[model samples]
Target: MKTAALKTVDRRDGKLAMAHFYVAFIALALGGLAGLLQTLVRSGKFELPAGIGYYQILTVHGVVLGLVLTTFFIMGFQLAAVSKTSGTLTNRQRLIGWIGFWLMTAGTLMAAAMILLNKASVLYTFYAPLQAHALFYIGLTLVIVGSWLDGAAIIMAYARWRKANPGKPSPLLTFMSLVNTILWIVATIGVASTVLIQLLPWSLGLVDRVDVLVSRTLFWYFGHPLVYFWLLPAYMAWYVVIPKVIGGKIFSDSLARMSFILFLLFSIPVGFHHQLTEPGIDPAWKFLQVILTFLVIIPSLMTAFSLFATFESYGRSKGATGLFGWVKVLPWEDARFTVPFIGMLSFIPAGAGGIINASHQLNQVVHNTIWITGHFHLTLATAVILTFFGITYWLVPHLTGRTLTKALNKLAIIQAVFWAVGMTFMSGAMHAAGLLGAPRRSSYSEYGGAAQAAEWIPYQVAQAIGGSILFLGIILMLYIFINLAFFAPKGEEEFPVGETSEKAEKTPMVFENWKLWLGITVLLILFAYTIPFIDMIENAPIGSKGYKLW
Candidate 1:
């Protein structure tokens, strides 16, 4: 590809991307407020008001931040990346994207209203037996369908590009974006199937009861991979965006493609790892999923190695002298580099904790404890959310044709630091308290006056402090983003597109074969899930009538 062509810019694409982002940030702000309230309540420093319950707040926090925010943001970012790297989307594609966006936004509003009204406080997972309003289920279904349409738009654009340039490797950003979208579409099947086939009817009174185990089984099938749906966009930054921000190229384009393919294949089938403690499924299947879970880790390790290699190569060329010297030579002053870099460092502990969670023996220790809570805060909150902040440092301005002021740039650095420090304190306390027998998803201040529970109080207080700081950080991020979008001076800034160190002029073509990888991904999902799903159905217990416990 010519350098000039690679620098393509399209305002139409930016508008569509920003539309998704606008909704995403709204979700972030509201959900983050709920997070603050959660910590306060847990710390025994605050109590819920008459109309607002703890679980209601928890449901909004999880759904808005975890599901709604991540989905919209990823779609926006992926669309933006594809347009810049590949080519502009046609008018029809833009129309489809807008339609999808409206559907998603409507769905979000419906779901939010239901949760706030205390009609759908079933929590984000919405596990069966905890019944919610039918509108809640229908709204969620619309969100899923909207996202599918959005993904389809991106895929269509890519397909057009491939048709125009037969045999050429798809641009790295486009390829990564496409793979992530496909992974999402495929991973969502588990949840969509359950929601459409079971939950909607059950909630609507078409079915008097629903099988608890079967519903849970279906949920876990989508639940674990849901984590990756959030992580991959962040990984795209670590792989593609960070390299460019630091003035280096990707170490190898082929390696990055391989990692994405591996994720597509391994991420879905490993959902059973989350159900290691559940009894309906046999231990044998759990073990198989555990092995598959470990397999998914390989791609992440590959990414770490590739990124280090890029840093080293750039560092040596700039006169750095030692194996570790590259660390100092990278662009530490750039918010675009440093913010996401902190996020990358966070994943080390988070990923290690995930291994423990997947372990059949070790999971018995921390399965329902706050330790799992700590683990995810590091992963999704720090590793994923921090990266999203970094992307916004440039992405918002890039879309709005605005200049990111030097003053605001420094503030961005402080924002990232606040998040890191706050998460460390909160997640640290969570881990310590959980190991001491603190349960998760509870509003327990007094453990029946047990002395052991007293130990957790101090940690809970620390969590409140950390939560406050993190809340402040998110508020700062929102202010900066809004300012960049509407108030900054107009300026020209190129979208950063990292070049392949050895460009794909003559790379192996096998890496670009989407059909081959997609086939294998489906096969692996079947291999891992078929027997267990069949068994669950054949010996399924009678469905239980739903309960409104809250």
Candidate 2:
């Protein structure tokens, strides 16, 4: 708000963005490998060696992709988005932020390496008594601590900007940074506590059997919140970037703020729905969580409503009118449509399955099946991968000062569609097969019994093909990132600013209020989290159950 000399903050973001590009691909590649191996194992095509090798691979894949890769990539996006949106800074505080990025990378690498080595068998959930090497716990903790430092840096820079120019309302993009950091701190508390206190000693063999529910409870506290952590940035990208790309305005500034606040509130508390398959949790509590889960969906639905509204407005301006006719007029080549298209497509399936599993009754049909896996990957993969695709492309020109080759950028977009469709078909089939009694977390699927595995043949082939598409997408993403990250020319010439560029004053704001948004955020989180908390803490029943690997 104070300066017109808007330039790209090519801090750790450009490097981290590129560095994280590698990390994202690695995580996806390994996870894909594991998924393929798992399919082979499930189909009786492959077998595991003696010992816990399958679990080790599964665990590493989970921790690497689920925790480390997503966190790093999301942080990179946040840094870039804030810098672009807030019209602030001159690299005074950015230097400090990049220092934090290296710390995060070191911690994540250390943890991932240990997991690959079979030192941590608890999954990223890091349950106790599943002793990992101490280094794993230390590495994990450092990653989280590093994030906190990064958060402080962003906040400090924003604070400085505010102090310099009073009464200037924070842009929605900057507002996202504020809420996201708050949610991050709130969510990570559970995992941070476990890593430092419960897990550190347990991994050292100081304890025999840790309370699995306690472990699960804390994990879910983080888990549900983690979902928001992933979704918010994507949603923000969708809100702030997508419409502008399509030549439209946000449906309502108030509606967008409402969605954010609701997400923070409900996302953290309703994690227990994940625990529905476990026996120790009581039915009453699970049901209550089911109710809270429903409540959470309402806000998400509002988000969907607002998103469609934004699109419709954009569509009409392009001279389209019909129930869904506006969809056709969109600039498909633009990062806005391409990114949101992938994201929206993924959410539909995920949300449908989510509603089913949110209930105690419906979860029974899908419980512990590949259906569960398919559903989550559909949700998370779309939300994180597609949006990251857009952010990278959007930032590349700014950071490198080189406009990406049109051909290469076009290839990236096509690759995204391939990944999205491939993941969808593959994951969708997994859900159907799961309903027919396929189990999860196994390296091999054939039990050597006489039962025919013919029905799964088509599904497996589809999944493999889909995996191939995703693999190609990742490869292309890496290639593009590498080119931009290192070799892309840094042009000295000035180019016209793109829409959604706040510093350029291209998009005008409709509302400006700090307390109003902050208060709404608090209220949403409270409503979302507390209702389910009551059901879980006080009402849920208990049972003793355990499963052992063969």
Give Cα-based local distance difference scores for all models. Answer: 0.87, 0.68
Any idea what lDDT model 1 has?
Answer: 0.87
Q: Which ten residues in a row have the lowest lDDT in candidate 2?
A: 493-502
Clash counts per candidate, in order, are: 0, 9
- List the candidate 1 regions with Cα displacement exceeding 4 Å: 1-3, 6-8, 446-448, 503-506, 543-550
Error of 2 at 366 (Å): 1.0
lDDT of 2 at 175: 69
| Model 2 per-residue lDDT tens digits across residues 1-550 | 5434555654455554445456665666676566555544554445666654767777776787787767777776676666665654446556666666677778878887787777776665666546788888888888888888777767875676667666755657766776787788878887887667667766775643455566677778788778778888888877777776666776766667667776765676676788887765666666666777787787788888877877887787778888998989887876536866777778977889888877778888888777877887788877666876777765665666676667766877887877777787778778887787666554334444435356665666666666656767767777777776667666531211223322223322323344665566566556545654455445433423331100
Query: Once model 1 is optimally superposed onto the true structure by TM-score, how far is the C-alpha of residue 382 displaced, in angstroms?
Result: 0.6
TM-scores of the models, in the order given: 0.97, 0.85
TM-score of 1: 0.97
